[model samples]
Target: MVENALGDANSVFSSKRAALRVLVNHGEKDGLTAARMILTGIPLDETYLQNRLSIPMNDEKKSLKGGRIHIPDSYYLMGTADPTGILKSDEVCIILSFWYMHQ
Candidate 1:
């Protein structure tokens, strides 16, 4: 009985360690993807932003600040010269700002 209990505990610990490793690997991959997107001046999709970055979009629970002329329902960033851009600036700066601030 003691041997069986020890084996079960070892199995559970190994399983949890493997799961943590997978999560860490995924996080590294996602970080690389975000960096590439920023460097290439590509706009991030809503799914990636919300799901991976954990930025809420179009949430009714959040209240908007008063006296704002233009209120965006979702966050956005685009390169300069794009008139329709929400956050108009270089992609690297915008993405880095979000990444650091979110942490």
Candidate 2:
């Protein structure tokens, strides 16, 4: 990750594992705090992400022609604001608190 005098501006490009660590750690401390951080931190370019990873960025439930499993709301999507200050429909993240067992 690249760093500047201002700070780690390249955090948006950090690996998924690193991002997950931050998310999980913060979540452990506080769910709302973690959710707020993720809401403000993740800087994904919707078009680029869609074209590169073939992942939808919205909370829709429509099925993709190739597969019904590809419904827009099938997975937790990341969201962000547009230039006009409107929240993008596709940029969303789900936060849940629950227990899990490691195998």
Highest TM-score against the true fold, candidate: 1
lDDT tens digits by residue: candidate 2, 23-86: 3323333433433444565443444432322212111112322233322223344544465655
> Model 1, 6-67: lDDT tens per residue?
23223322343322222333346664554454346544443553243221111111212222
TM-score of each model, in listed order: 0.21, 0.20
lDDT of 2: 0.33
Candidate 1 vs. true structure, TM-score: 0.21
Q: In model 1, what is the error at residue 83, expressed in angstroms?
A: 66
Judged by lDDT against the true structure, how good is candidate 1?
0.36
Local accuracy by lDDT, each model: 0.36, 0.33
